[model samples]
Target: MASVLGPLQPIVDMVTSPLFLQIVLFPGLTSIAIIGALLGWLERKLTARVQLRVGPLYASPAGGILQMFADLIKLAFKELFVPENSDAFFFIMAPTTGLVLGAALVGLIPFAPGLQIANIEVGLPAFLAIITLSPTLILLAGWSANSKFPFIGGLRALFQQTAYEIPLWLSALGVIMMAGTLNLAQIVAAQSTGWFIIPQALGAFIFLVTSVAEMERLPFDLPEAESEIMMGWQAEYTGVLFLAAQGPGFVKLYAFSALFSVMYLGGFLGPGFLPPLFWMLLKTLIIIVLIMLLRSTFPRVRLDQLLRAGWTTLLTLAILNIGITYLLVVGLPTL
Candidate 1:
């Protein structure tokens, strides 16, 4: 028996390795999917509370916590409907692309020490590049539908992402300057002295606001404004394709929130009470709750207003943040 099992030892070790666990279990697809589903239910429940109504109670006995999973199951079994004149290839590819990119971005994020899938040197730039793919995929999704509303929605998405991505990149320069490395782990390590949120408050604010826009949530959800555009670029998708398209947004929300925690909230650096991963997760949940609250409390803004704010207000703030960071790092020498 020992001789027979000796040859399989390497395979067993490979399967149970930390890297494999990181990729398949915690801080990976399974965890992200669970979190996304819970967030969906949480958003509805919280919003319903604010609106003074019961929401999704019939889906499960436990305050409708299982509603999102139920919906996903229903969607998976439902018939897939393709538009008659739509470009079938792009239509199918669009959502798949978004889901892939979203997962890739999540994989890059370091949840805790030695717990990341990728720890590239140019992580920040690579992250920004991956985020830019979302808008392009949205455009493809809308245009491939060959419908009026979806096309309009795609154009709006393109414009919105283009406007906000500038400030998003500029805002992170403050952290990059202070940390002096694009590697996320190094950035977190540098925050041992203090979290960047203190001195880089302006940049942090810009990042928070632009992250909302990046995820296309609440007030920034002009592209998918259901009241005005009838679900916008997602109008033509059904069944699994719809899941592939819409599911990534929630995952991206989690990814962005985690990124925010890492960049500004000091990643996993905390008192040694629970664990590094626990602290990271706790901070992420707090940010997620804040975002959900924003969703529940705020109304969607007009496209023009969104554009103007992104271009003028956000851009100016990002510039000021960069200047302030430069002054502090260069003049003070202690930052």
Candidate 2:
């Protein structure tokens, strides 16, 4: 019996290891992939409901819940297709890098008290910095395709991301002011007295609008507008290349929604009945649903309208929110 137990000790140790569980399972590469796939299904099912249709009923016995997993398997075996004269290296690398960046965004978020894989002191800044890299990659993919439409699509993405990011950063600055720390976990703890959404409502609104733009969804999805440029910068990708190109959109949605939960919805703070992880996830899903609803509800805006709103309207509102937050932060002691 002792000899038999000894042989399995290494297996037991490896399974129980903290790094393995966190990095490979929850809030890591594998989890990111799974969640991104499920979220794709969720979007379709939800959009179908909006149009008075039943969604995803065939892939599995229960409402086609396994449809996305099945799709993932199919995509894994799909062939890679590159354009005639395209630079295959960067064309392939761009979307893969987007997937990695999406996973990296989750690492900075604290799901529960002890759940963060990496707890950087300047977590907020770190997340903002990493997300900014996504647009450049989009441009890279479009240019590497060596086609006019894709290059044009990539340029649109570059312009869109550049226009909106200023407002996004400004809106987040309000949170940094009120919380008085860039650490994400500490921000959650600071909300013990009250949530930031109450005082920072304007900032949250600006953040949501800008975030949708950053994710390139719905009204802001000019880069991949099917009718206009035939999937835009994503035109040349097929099979697994297409999956790699598109998977990060869902992954980024999850990451951004989780960030929204942490900053505006109080991270993992909730009533004691349910566990902390449950509450955190609940908030993140709610945010995800809200964003998805926006995708279904809004008409696609022209690029000019999008840039105008981002630069003028959202930017103004963000600055105003910052001013209000400054007053709140300084006046709290007096009150």
Candidate 3:
């Protein structure tokens, strides 16, 4: 068979490899696209129900489950044109790269035993570092439009990310201190006695807040405020470019929610009767719902107010949480 197959054998072997499946199928491009689409429908359905209305219908016969797919198709089909004198190369590439980075964040997350796409030792920090690049890309996308509104939006993106990013890192700092490991899988292992949420409740709150801000959910959605900035950084984007601009948020939502589950809720740990994957997924879904609910209820905040909260209030809380963590580690070394 080897003699007959020759060069084709290695291609088959590569296709069959678990690494390929992990990257191209489960936790990579295909899964990210599907999950991001489904999550869009979920968010709409959840918000609609909360506000007492039928959300998406007619896209799919069953509960409009295919609405997002329909929307994606529509977006792809729409005609679009680039602004004159704009840096068209970056105007198109930035959002596409942001979507890829969003999927890459999921690559580091452990969904179940033996299910991680890349179980790097510094998975936690690497995830943060990769995601931080997203806003920079957004800034690039906005600036590349070569228009007044987008330039302002681009500046806002830079400022907003700069404000919340530190608190985000500090919030996770307590997790690192408690778990005493940078590897996400090992962090889950450290929660064998109890979840980090109990001791690091304050940090978890800061994380939840910062995560919502980082994802630019309402109240934190100043950069692209539809009512104010006419969609802000994405004003000039249309058709597939528009799709690229919008898609990353949902992907990031899934990745960030999964990361929260891993860091606080214990990645895939659960009762013997329930599969590890089930628990991980259920937790991730719950966090996703909570984020959607927040979107529906939280008032849009001013950029200055949001920045102040991030730098002063959230920063102080994050620092205080770290101090508490130090005391706990000193008093209860076994924990």
Candidate 4:
């Protein structure tokens, strides 16, 4: 019997390896979650500073480092509110689906050579596909709440998704054209000569803009327009459920920043003195800070303006970027 199964032993061992389980699933999920939480704190603190007010100072005076934790605890203890008319089942399930799907994407993202949880050949497509589902889940959550605010929020989110998805994918196509690979690991490796940002600057800018829209952060947070809709789709959620929903929102931001770092900024390609993981983390942090700064500085654009920018401005720019990249590929001297 042992001899009969010998041929499959390596496969089985690979599946059951402690290293794979730890490094891939556990660490990846934990790290992203922690980063996401910290980012939430940073966004609040920085935005407050920009607005000339203190942010979460009672939680931790230095910089409100524990603000997110305090918020999390408060959320955990709050009452779970469910409208009598709402579909309780889907209301409960929507946030869970969004959180899981977003977190799972981290597995397919490679931080550096030999450091990824999974190295799928079609990583970029897989990521795009997974990310596109998040808005649908948010829509579901909003509709399930059976409230006017949430329903409106869901509709806004759907429209925002429709508006931005095209340019987002088009911009990614530019990167794919330049890198000549959809696999993120190969994409990062191609940057060994130089980061793609230098040549693909337009594509990077398109991506950054679309990614911010995707994140639904300030200036693009029309879906959750507090002044207009009052917390939008998450109005009814309370306790841990609300926290869970917020968790995935931040995770999406972190994952996108990580992907941007890998695709354009040279993932983990620092000097020999630093480890690959350190370099990757540093790059991701910088991107996140930039995002935070943008959130602090900009006012939310009107919905009509957002639509016009996405359709006219970003789409045109992305198309031009692709054409330029193609020209450079054909015209540049061979190495």
Among these predictions, the greatest TM-score belongs to: 3
Q: What TM-score fits each model?
A: 0.95, 0.94, 0.97, 0.91
Top lDDT: which candidate number? 3
lDDT of 1 by residue, 1-335 (tens): 25456888888788899888888898788888898889888888888988998987988769988999999999999899899999999999999989889888888888888899999999888888999889889999999999999999899999998779999999999999999999998999999999999999999999999999989888898778888999899999999999998898888988988999999999999999889999998999899889988988899988888889989999999999988999898885563
**How should the candidates be ordered by lDDT, best one leading?**
3, 2, 1, 4
Colliding pairs, model 2: none
Candidates 1 and 2, the one with greater lDDT: 2
Off by over 4 Å in 2: 1-15, 332-335
- Give lDDT per model, in order: 0.90, 0.91, 0.92, 0.86
State the lDDT of candidate 4 residue by residue for 1-335, as single tens digits. 26556788888788778656645455477677677778888888877888998887777757778889888888889888778999999999999888888787777777767877878899998998999998898899999998999899888899899879999999899879888999999999888999999999999999999999998888799878888899888888888889877898788888888999988999889898978888998998899889889988888888889988899999999999989999877776667
- Minimal lDDT window, size 10, model 2: 1-10
Give the TM-score (vs. native) of candidate 1.
Answer: 0.95
* Model 3 Cα lDDT, one tens digit per residue, 1-335: 54567878888889989999889998777989999999999999999998999999888889999999988999999998999999999999998898788888999999998899999999999999998897899799888999988888888989999789999999999999999999999999999899998999999999999999889878788779888888889999999999999999999999999999999998899898999999999999999998999999888988888889889999999999999999888775564
Q: Comparing 1 and 4 by TM-score, which wins? A: 1
- How would the candidate models be sorted by TM-score, starting from the highest? 3, 1, 2, 4
Which is better, 3 or 4, measured by TM-score?
A: 3
Kindly give the stretch of ten consecutive residues in candidate 3 with the minimal lDDT sum.
1-10
